[model samples]
Target: MKISKKKILELLTSGKYVPSTFKAIAKILEVKDKDDKKNLRKLLKELIEEGRIIRDSRGRYVIPGENMVIGDIQFTRRRFGAFVSRDDGEEVYIASDDTGFALDGDRVLVEITGTYRDLPKGCVVKVLKRGRTRIVGTFVTRGLFAFVIPDDPRIKYDFYVPPEGFNGAKPDEKVLLKITRYPSPGRNPEGVVDKVLGNAMDPAVDLPTVIFKHNLPEPGYFPEEVLKEAVKVAKPPTKKEISKRKDYRKDRIFTIDGEDAKDYDDAISIKKLKNGNYLLGVHIADVSHYVREGSALDREAYERGTSVYLLDTVIPMLPFELSNGICSLVEGEDRLTLSLEMEIDPGGKVVDFKVHEGVIRSVRRLTYTEVNRFLNGDNDPDLLKHLEPVKKELLVARELARILRDWRKKRGSVMDISSREVKILFDEKGRVVDILPQERGESEIMIEEFMIKANETIAEIFNTQDIPFVYRIHEKPDPESIIQLKHYLEAIGMKLRIPKNIHPKVLQEILEKTKDHPLHSSIERILVRSMKRAVYSERNIGHFGLASQAYTHFTSPIRRYPDLIVHRLLKKIIEKGHFSPEEIDRYEKELPRIAQHCSKRERIANEAEWDLLDMKKVEYISYHIGEIFDSVITGVTKFGLFVEIPEKMLSGLVHVSTLDDYYEYNETQNILVGKHKKRVFRIGDGVKVRAVHADKTTMEVDFVIVEKENNKNNKRNNSKNKAKKRKKKRRS
Candidate 1:
């Protein structure tokens, strides 16, 4: 058996194996064969690289003691940083000066420098791996040498580019630079231009730079080999293929998506059974059928992880021939799919379910607005023409959706968290028209409920079968974060009792109780900030957000790589009784790494989308500069207050310096109070502000306070002065 790091550490720590050379250690462990000894050496090297093992002066391997820790270093804007332990220990605080050459996202060996207030303080002792080799920045010429300023603020050093490394990049042009040498004692890191990305002001350069910076796929283009394969496999399913699967063409099936949606990966058909149970058939595109394992398409899908939805564009995980054309469950098209046929009771319990490899023809393509309007009783003739037979099905689906929603709420889902999705409208010239919150009506909720149920059903099946799988896990909130959130809420006159062992329902109760309060959004925002980000993991740790013991992404395989993986894993179970031991072992060994990679890629996609959105938001606000906007304080920091315009969905900073009176930040109270003027600005407080400045490059908009509506300090001061004058007159 291959020895794992844990087993090796256990052996060393147990004092069963003497600290010796790798070969000697191997002999002590009864690994006598030549191949076993070689394998043991490889494992030792892996441990050493992971910082779990070290060599003494005599070249004997031993586990690193308590002083050292292995983890990924996260650098913040303020020079200080934190080391998130790879072994899942509490995060160690790293002072700015102690960070040394470790950059953000780098895996390093941290030596515990000391402890501050029960928190472990660490200093970087060794850089195990570099997170980035290429940096994206704007080129600037300084006499003889060119310097590239990184767009990411976390990167502290600018790259010094020699004259030969310019690569035809003009000054102020965006460029991707490759670091040739890291920073030395008194010098900056040296780099050469890898790609010239044209002028920063050009509209075309905006997304391309973000793509290159985030290492996303080349926009709208697939590899020639992948394209050829996609073209070959893009044909419609044949007679034999149709004969082997269930056909759902005659069922009043349809897809409900955004009006601009091109890739429809999931379609639904709901019907009421004779016994009053609901039959919910959620058909997902069978992407695994076309993109086989180890194929070029599969490799590219794995690399992209998920489709990135920018303001108006989507960088799809699959090529257009597959993602948009063949694999997309478009209207009236005979497409291959995997359907989760669930029989849910009136009480929102899944009574029974079956997974099927099927073929489906979506009868209609209805947008969310159309379905929402129909549900709201506005049955326009034009809308009726599109929604036809599926209208009745949608009604049944809506009832089931309400039942499912109630069930989920009872199970601990946080229903009061306001949706943060915003829609950015652009004109024909690609200029911003307006920014508004994306409406979440009943139709959207119905679809969401169905998808959640489908994903949970699939997760439960695989989990019960004891097969290797990937789960979408959202862990409970950290204790420290919960404590901080409670303190913030208490400062706002809201009370939150956090138990020693926190549950999602415990937090959900607080949100539900304050759902109608004026500060509901602020409380929900803090709660969201306090929770951990959901990620893909091989272990089924349960989804805290959905409050499901078993949950995975099973709905949008064409867009998500993990869903595609789930489809493949499920197909193996469907075709064969179960996956072979070898197959199961392979998945067990590889899935954790795949989960990490997909999670990282997902973050990149989110960051890229957010970056483009911020660029557009800045651009939109730049046009309205000097105009006053009614805003609400969303956040308060030492630097200033963060205020958002409700109507426009635009957020800008109200800098402390821009305030007329001197203001002091009360961190514990979570507010800014003017010292003499006594004007108070706390989170959720409404105020009027003028957009003073906006920078597209920085993606920041600055706001100046326009008016202080309730000037209590002025009235109080006037009263005091009058009383003082009256007293002086009486004395005279």
Candidate 2:
């Protein structure tokens, strides 16, 4: 008696039941039996939920159109939005009026009305789910009521807080508010103050505000149950457990990380094999052994997905008891690890590899700076003492790392593009003292190369076995993005010859061709933005950037949930040699959702980290408001020219309105041309700019052009001529 929803929808759209109510439709469909009628009703409900059919004001079910799509609508500050489909289709634009009560990040059913200037336009028909109920904002109390002004720009309307829900928060203080009622067409959403964060301008409250704004987990507060389990798991492995692992205590294993880094999850060791090959070992802390499946700690870790490292603090996925203690591969401590042994040839090929559980005591805990110095013969007594035992092994590791790097470079055409990551140093009062980039050294690259190889090895092994696994997949870039990139390159006077069969090498070649250009960094960033974002997936789409057929995240289990899952599955495969049918089926059924959840969580963490960095950068730049600095025109848009101060790596906008002459943006040329003066300010042009404004709420900086050097020279020449004329007149 179960009616197919698809059949119901097809019949409704087929026009026979046109404008028919539920009772009439039921009668026409010949559903006389009570059970059959119930099935029909259920089918109708299902169809409605799926957005295939909708009930009109007169209670008749009808299909809106073939263009009806379900997706998450991301609204901008001005109310215009984009509908991001769940199935990864082309985005649909939702005009301000078309977005009916659909807030930012809200899942909704949208019907594509028609094309607007070649872009698909949609209207929100129904809100499937609310993305957020609470928002972090500044509280402003009026006579009888208050409103929370959302910090996120995408939230167009302020949440109205009734007097009772004000929670004693003062005006201008940042507060977290929970929506009591959603906003209708004409009414603003109603909310109540849930928690009062301190003054909005206080430097001390910045991090907390950001954490709340992003719904990031508070540091040091674990669920009581999770904490108890973590505490139990904190103890070092017992002798029995150690006995089960392969002992590598005598190996020259060491961990290289930042000096300020905690929770060291990985260590590396290498030795010269007699056959002219190298034996390299990558030991990762075996967090999966301690965090059991379906346990509170595991659930929490899964929820976090990845550790969020802000400038001064880290919001770890696992509790400190696990992350910084037992799971940390600290020097002189016997830590249990899931180790990867790779026999790499001189050509940087991993000839053979094996994954196994191992027990290792790191001989030294070294920083990248220390290693870099050691390689340069900076033999400080303490550094020498720590590194002397592993000097030969270190030399071998460096050679292998170089070989691997060179091999990767030779194989891929695109030059690896990386920006120097900056760290914000805060004073005791939480004010920014210094913002400096973390120096990249060969030691860092060595570790990176080894990790990449291990990840690839693990992915290859599991992929060939046909097991359900989470892969770090980077798909091919969209054709539209490539087209835009080509136009941008041409605007910059660079010719990019796209191959008939486009691959990573094609993009790599473009980078190589423009390597010496002043706009290389900007071009590289554009190229990166044009590519698809890497995400976790059950499907094995080859990693486009790495040019690898198989790739997965297999290291840092203590910090990354995907790595933890990889560890658990890897351990199972190693033990059983192959997974049973049920095990495979279970993983297949569950991995898609897991991959999606983890990917989403990672994105949230990344966004939150970036936001905090932007806030810190603004705070730092605010001190230099009137100072002029040499900046590069990094981006040109219709509204403004984006400039980057190369020395500080700080970027700000030079708004079109700030220019003395009227400016028109040439979209095709990717430059702004002055209407009256015909002055061209294109990307990559160096100019002096005064730091004009830095706003915290908007997280934006504004810059006005100070006279260019050439202009200053011209003015100097004119002044000299005028002075000479005055002197001649005086003499006469």
Candidate 3:
């Protein structure tokens, strides 16, 4: 059932005094069935006594006015704040002096005293909940009771630690802190150091740990419990089980991925029909065989929801013993797989398809680079000898991929340039040795195209079946961001005439023209970020960015939990032929929470990746703090200009006050105009700057614009302004 605005208002008006009960009210309003209705009502009584909601003495619902609105926080580096009030679709402006104690990303309740563009401006009257207790910080020993300050500057406070709380940690070591005392009602939150990482500079171990701290379950080096469970579970494709399904192990098949890939979730086998249609088997590893519902491993995988890749390291959802060993499709070994077999002609259309359970033996493990080299007619003897058949299939697959890519691009898909991982080679002491971009060759594209094809096809399959499963859907950008981006581009005397609704094709054409145009990379980034975040949801919203009629994450179940759920849901309806509508409804009600959880955790993983890259960049810059570099002004704000050093991905700030002249920001044009010197700096303009400081404690790099003549001219203009001001004051 669709949510009714009247029913929600009634619950809000009813006296509920607790936060948990407010959550219950949300759930009650969302559910369609009779069973879910009972649980929500049971919790309503507890909410009445918690003062979270007030009941007038006359006995009627009197929810706090602040409780009426909820919004996602928009965090800044400053102690100041503003929340994007989703309830009212406005920026809730917060004064720097009024922050009190709330920090970034903390959800809180506020009173909507002012509405700006239908959004609210209000003080955070209460913190509804603390998202997490664990935070990463570095220790400092001063006295018998030392403290640890969080590496995340937004935390605003340090932890107080006794010797025992150090857990064998020494001074200046990086450690994890567990909040022991929260700033309750009116107090500041304090924590005790719980775990000590060996050193502050050890990147190998700490990088993965930071990835785990975000409540994402990591595939441990050795998790014996899950390993044991995986080992005991039998594949049991006995005669009886095999008889119920089709077996296609004899078809020549192969898997193509990165050279370092351990978990092979998808494989391809191809054959040409008499009428020129192609039968392509997109066999995926049947992960559901090993991971059963409610099992220990399943529970852990559910919690993690996706694999996190930080540079060369992988924090997988399943234990390596399973992901890399049992489930991995090794060459020459028979493995169970769930497949989408498709029949398409040379025109690159998916005319017909079937989803089946089967067995397959991969003939070889092929690398993407080798396939690319072969395709370019620059093959070595080894590639020709070993990967010839695979390349043949890839040629046919690429034709299909080309068709698919064109079809989507023509349909308004927002295309993205290939961004490889910035591989940083480090010395034993964690010092950067070299930095280079990872090569994404032909094999990668072919595999990606195939996986996308399978995902979209199965997404339609699920939509037609009416089964509830999580989909990776991208929404359109908010109006504010689009306007901001337009202004930024116009400041450089260029403008993209994007459609008001911003369909994918317009952006794709702009990207195609802007390729390799000096400011291309940064402008592309703005376009990419101008869209709403892609997340998992049960609804088939029709992925705006991908420009697909239906889309999902069907492949890579070994890495992503939503894909695993998709596989299971698809299998139940496709193979089993019948399923409980009630159960799907249950999933429809439940999967949104998991989808929200997975999306948030994915962001945390991304943050960890950027954190590692930035730490490496900081380490890379420690040696060059005083050196000058040529940079492009990628961003300009009231506070500073962000100059991107293209040779290195390090961005530094040229503070507003350091400009040597009085300047005012022109928000409409994304430029800072010097009042006296009359110089202007905006996004995409080239500027030279000298590094002034690199503060590791704050992860801030300060720069001074390096034109001496410009500075001298500005100083002379400033003196003239000062003299004029004095004359006016004297006359007055």
Candidate 4:
């Protein structure tokens, strides 16, 4: 008798087949020869590796089932537990004791043990693959023993380093370590120092530390082949290429961005038509034009997924020759673009539109500040002169933007959530000088409105054509989250009725009602949290946040990989009119995986940026220890209250131990109550706090309550404090 891989899979998949050991399977198949048994064993091993079959604890070959899952494990920020994110989008919770030495981001086989808090609870049965081999941390030595404390808070364990593995690394310095041994039930992981970054306090080491910590690509380092391809692809638009594209080189088209922005990926132009409609043209850099599909440049860009813009630095997705040179819609340079021209009526209805590959030379480059100043009636001669060329265009753009914004609001878009963005200013020596909250002026809003309209227009086009496309989808809020939000809202004394199947319009109404409330920011923060995160998807479920039926990111191809893919898809449609059946099938199979990869990469980039920002914030606040600031409690937990300083957008924890009275956390109401004094601290409570400590390594700030002002409101607390002081003196 003979055995084969196909036969093994068929047997396992058969309804009558029961899980059996290698010997049992061989006997059932009547494999009497020794060589046939060896062949059967090899086939079984290959099938298991391919995930076509799995093994039970008793070493029997079985099919994967609901009781078992394979997924990547992500530890919580507090490191108490982890969640395994499976391929089908289900998350299983893994308690700390059940983790079986699995680290963050490892792919593991988990056996579903039971249920925890409405989610499947699981334990790691086997670690299929390690997610990371390198870690960035601070090296320390104590009495002939050494270890590296990881900078990532999610990574809880300290990797032990042997004396010979130090590799000349010094104490308290940031170093990159390569893992030599993984952890087990009883032992810690071990690593060897690969490179000494520098002193933790050195400003020069900040970028490298964050880069290594996040496993980001080194800035300005491109593979030789990628660079060569970039150089070949970044050439100026040739005569033949321009002849093929719609030429808008002489149009009054220009770009508006931040004063410091260099990669101008999007440009705009507008005009009022005779029928009182606005002719708006949005030109985005055609990044896919240069970086062909499956090329080295495209592969590198896909791997990066998106550019990481760290404060004062950037890790770009494409090489400089493409991202900053030819692909950037620089002033007075003819650059290739995918243009969307829309005819919007006064009521903000898009009556007609056209999408085309075009060539445009930006007439001028504008900044948000100058355009805002001119629009706000600032009469400075220099400012007026700087924007004189396209003054009418700017005004028309403003008019059209207002109409579009009002239309979006009328359609129930979530528009009133005010987000505070802070700009960390650095001095000549790269030291933090100030942290100022950035204001979005009218010009900023105008650009946002235009971009949104363009994105919606492009998305609708592909969706109507029934083409396989990547969409920027924001699903509706989960009913469970909305219920929690409703309870919290009631607790905060806002009596708003929430429906089980809530609509985005209801959320909009809530924001409108709470716009002037003292806890507006806190409410906004909570509402944002209650909503699901927006991600790229091949399935168009509509964007709940923006109140759009179809939406995609078609702008900023220079920075975002999805936009580049959109461009390629749009170009394919424009050139071929429609995809062949085979092409459609291929894209249908590929787009979901691509969307998932890009979504994961985007999340990593966002986390890295936030981590670096938090580090800088802690560094800045370290200079202001003991200074009192007004703050609002944003979160309540058993351990402490998380408060954010509203003015600077800096947040810190007010530990329970730091409170004067012994407090008990009320989990149901999400509040903390003093055991004897009856003092209550809940979300949105205003308090005066003094910054007590800041830890750069942990990226955490500690705040202590300043009782002087708070005492004025509570005489009992003051009296209790005096009584305690008197008792302490008598005891002394």
Candidate 5:
């Protein structure tokens, strides 16, 4: 068996001294073929390179006991930078000295010098390897001296660039630079500008800045070979293909999506059976049909992992030829799809189900707005009497959607909603003209509800067949995070009402209470943030958000790679009936790694999206500096209360030191209590503020609390707030 990296580290720490001789190690390892010097040399070289085994003064190997072990480098940005020693998927603090020469994200060998209680602390004695090649930053100049200030605060060191070394760029330009010379002695990290995009304040540069910062793969079209393969979709599921599977093309099915949606991945059909049961068919685009395994297109899709839609632009996984054409379930087009046909009883219970590959013909491509308008009593050319049958069935679908939603929630689904979205409106130059709220309505929710049912049903079917499938699992919130959340809510004058079992039902009652209140959005926002992010995994852990017993992503295989994996697994199961024990072992072993990769890719996507949104928000508020507004405290720290404005809904700090009263921070309550006046400003409290400064370089919109009196006597308070805001802006 091939040993894991952790196992290698474990062997190094087992004994105080490991024999220097290869023969001794081979004997200890119980290898009968002792004369195989090549393999033994390879092992020795690997160990030395990894810093597991070290050669002492006279060439004797020594395993440095429990004090030394190799682990990944991690950095946490606090007042005093703390590099992690052993996170083990949890936070474990280590000092900067512990990091030694190990770069961020690098796997290194460290000597565990000490421990504070149960917390493992270490000092890196060796550098195993380097980590990243790219660095994202903006160039700044002071006289003749120039430096590249990193956008990521976690990057502890700045880059020093000589005037000529910048390679043809003026000061204050946002550039993608490569680390040419790492820090040595008192010098900072030095680099040369690899690509100069534009000025830091240029609106067009922000998207590229976001892309570079997250280390997301550059958005590029698939290669010629991949495009050729992707474009080659089987003409139309032939007579032979139809004979091997079920046929749903003649079924009165239709797709509902956004007005601008190009790739329609899912379609739904509903009909009344003679047995007094409803037949519901959930049809999905068979993307795996054309993008076969081990192809160039497949590899690119795997690398991308999922489609990334940023504002109006989409970085699609598969080329447009496949994603928007052959694989898209367009209206009146014959497309191959994986269909889930289920017989639903009057009570919304799925009595019987079958999964099959089939040909589908979508009768119409209906937009949510069009359907919702019709449902809400409005006439349209597409639905003015000619679409009466489709419209009536749409209402029936909504009713069925309600039944499914109720059933899922009753089973244990946490259905929560929040009003937090950036609706993009771009001008002719692709510059953002406006960023509004993306309103969620009943029609969208109906589609979501049906999709959830389809996914859960497929998960159950694969489970029953003993097939290996990728499940969209969301584990419970971290115990520490949950505890912190509970305390935070309590401090805000509310309680979680969590029960002993720790289920979504604990939050259900709370959700129902604040359905449409002003603070409703904020409450849901906090709750959602408190929960862990959902990720793709082969293991089936029930979904916490959906509150489902079983869940898998089967609806959008065209965008999501995990869904494609699931689709392939289902097809295999359909043909072979079950997965072999060996195949199960392989999947079990590989799943953890797959989950890790998918999670990382998902983070990249989120970061890219959020970074762009933050830039846009910053730009949106840049014009409103010095404007006054009403606000409420959304966050509290020792430094100040973070006040969020009501109009634009942007958050800025109201420093405690600037409150015109001496204050002390209360750790337990997350508040700053004024000493003399006894004035208390805490999280969730109301406060008025005025925007004093908005710095584009820092992307910070600063605000000072609007005190009733700001005369000559209050000069110190105004100065303090101004000074604090300026300091933060400069640092950022």
Candidate 6:
């Protein structure tokens, strides 16, 4: 009998059918001919590859269902377990023991066992594909046996190397490896050394190690095709092109950014209208015009999603010819822009607005520091002369920004959450000299308010028109996370009344209450984590954090791909007013995939940036071992108290075993209590700790508590020794 793929699918979908092996399935179908059996095998393979059927570890074929899920598994840094982000928007927790042979980033089939703490728990049934083919690690030898310990903390297992697989790699050296065999029960994965990076402590290898581990694209490197396209498009606007666009070159427009900023993508101008309103012009670089859809530059930017700023290095989303050349809104240069001019009333309402493709010459390029100083009564002759052309517009911009900020606050936006960002200062030799927290001045907030208004105005326009567009959505926090947050707040001696249907206002209120608290920064971070991450989506779900009805990333097109996409869609709307049926269908089909890819890429960039930052923080702290620093208890667990040096924002584990007294963990109160001394350590407690260890490889630090009396004693000892030396000198 001839076997068809449809018949096999029908058999699998039948209520009476049970999962079976290929042989059992063939026998059930009554395939007697050898050719029929071969055909059946091919059909099964096709179905599995198309995700129509799942192949279990025991070589049985089953239909995908509630009991099973497929996703990429990510191991936790703690190595206790892994989480599988399912394709259907659910996350399943897989314990370390139940992971089977699956490694980090592997696409696996998981069998749902039950729920752990309200989250679905599962075990890896089979690995369908490997996410990584190469691994970077440190090679070591133990009694003639060799192994490579993975540099990524998320990878829990070490790969074994046979004698012949060394490839001349010496022990204690950094080496790249190619996996030859995967791990099994009670057996380690095996690999062959591909290449030697360098000695583990060599600073020269640091950049390559991070780049290889995160699969980051090389900085300042572009494909020949991409570079050619960039150069071709990086041209000054012609007179014909300039005539077609609205002329804003004579307007009092300027850009506000950091002193070291190179690429100016956004500029602003404000004017006081006659009817007690403000006319705000937000001009963004027209990156979409230069980077046409389906072009090499466009494809590269979409893949990058956003720029990655790693310390002093930048892995930019677009080539320099575009990002730093034609697309940049440089001072005194006639640049093309997509402008949004909004007439906002005194109540901060955008009563009328127009989106225009325009050309502008930035009258002045202002730095945040100088503008801030000028606003705060600085009257230096040179500074005043430089800002003379656009100073009045800047003042008007600040006034309008204040009104908008107030309007957002009244609408229940979570605006007071301080983002903790540190600037790592480097000396002439590229050594980290100091780390300072980046302060957000009034100018920074003013620019932010203006951008928010512009983004919201654009998003509202497209959403109300029922057009296909990408939105930046921030969903409400999960109920379980809110409950946990309440518990955490109670432990910190704050009481919160959580309603069944919570709103962003409640979180805003919590932040407001904690603004002056000693642990304000820590509490802010916890609240931020408790909320869901903001992501790009084709559906307009609204932005919870900003408390905006409709929001999209319509700014910073030079750096963000989503914003570039928005620019394209806006231009279409501007030209045609509405999409044709075919255009609408095409965008509807493509927008979701584009949104998902861009969101994933953004996450990858963020992780890579944070990884490099953590590495640098550890490297800086390595030189300060044996020094005492004041810290705050950020976390309390049975194993240890996690403390962070507030000044440096460096965290380390204070193991329970090193404590002066035996401590018992109180889960209800989330505190560690000393059994005999009655001393308690909970989140937000101030303590002085001595840095005991710092490991660059693991990116971990260890700290021990220093008693208050001991610190005083050391100070007294130094004073006495100084007096004795002075007396001895006098006697001589």
- Candidate 1 C-alpha lDDT tens digits along 299-337: 988988999987677888999999899999998889999
By lDDT, the better pick of 2 and 4 is 4
Give per-residue lDDT, candidate 6, residue 221: 91
Instruction: Supply every candidate's count of residue pairs whose N, Cα or C atoms clash at under 3 angstroms.
Output: 0, 2, 11, 0, 3, 0
Clashing pairs in 5: 67-112, 412-547, 413-547
* Model 6 agreement with the true structure over 247-331: per-residue lDDT tens digits: 9998999999987788899999899989899999999999998999999999999888898877678888999998899999999
Candidate 2, residues 48-120, lDDT tens digits: the string is: 6555677765788777667777766766544456555453434788888788887787877787788766578
Better of 5 and 6 by lDDT: 6
Model 3: per-residue lDDT, tens digit, 51-153? Answer: 3443333444446664345444545555555663342223576555444456566655555567555355666655544556777777887767687777775
Best by lDDT: 4
lDDT per residue for candidate 5 within 51-162, as digits (tens), equals: 5666554555567566666555666544254554331233344677556555566666666666754566667665555566778788888788888888765677778887
TM-score for each of the candidates = 0.86, 0.86, 0.82, 0.89, 0.85, 0.88
Candidate 4 lDDT by residue in tens digits, 1-732: 667887878888899998899888888888889888888888887666545577776889988886888888889888789998776556899998888878888888899999987799999998767888999999998788999989887887899999889999999999999999999868899999999999987766778888998899998998999999998888999999999999999899999999889899999999999999999999999998898999999899999999999987889999999889999999999999999999999999999999999999998899999999999999999887878889999999999999999999999899957766789988898877778888799999999999999999999988999889999999999888898788778777788988888889889998998888767777887899899999999999999999999999999899999999999999988898899999899999889878988988898999888888888888888888767799988888988889998778888887786787999999888999999999999887899887767767777677878888544535434433443443344223
Worst 10 residues of 5 by lDDT: 84-93
Q: Each candidate: what lDDT?
A: 0.82, 0.83, 0.70, 0.88, 0.72, 0.87
Cα error of candidate 1 at position 567, Å: 1.1
TM-score of 3: 0.82
Q: Any idea what lDDT model 4 has?
A: 0.88
- List runs of model 4 lying over 4 Å from the truth: 1-63, 114-120, 667-669, 709-732
The deviation in Å at residue 65 for candidate 2 is: 10
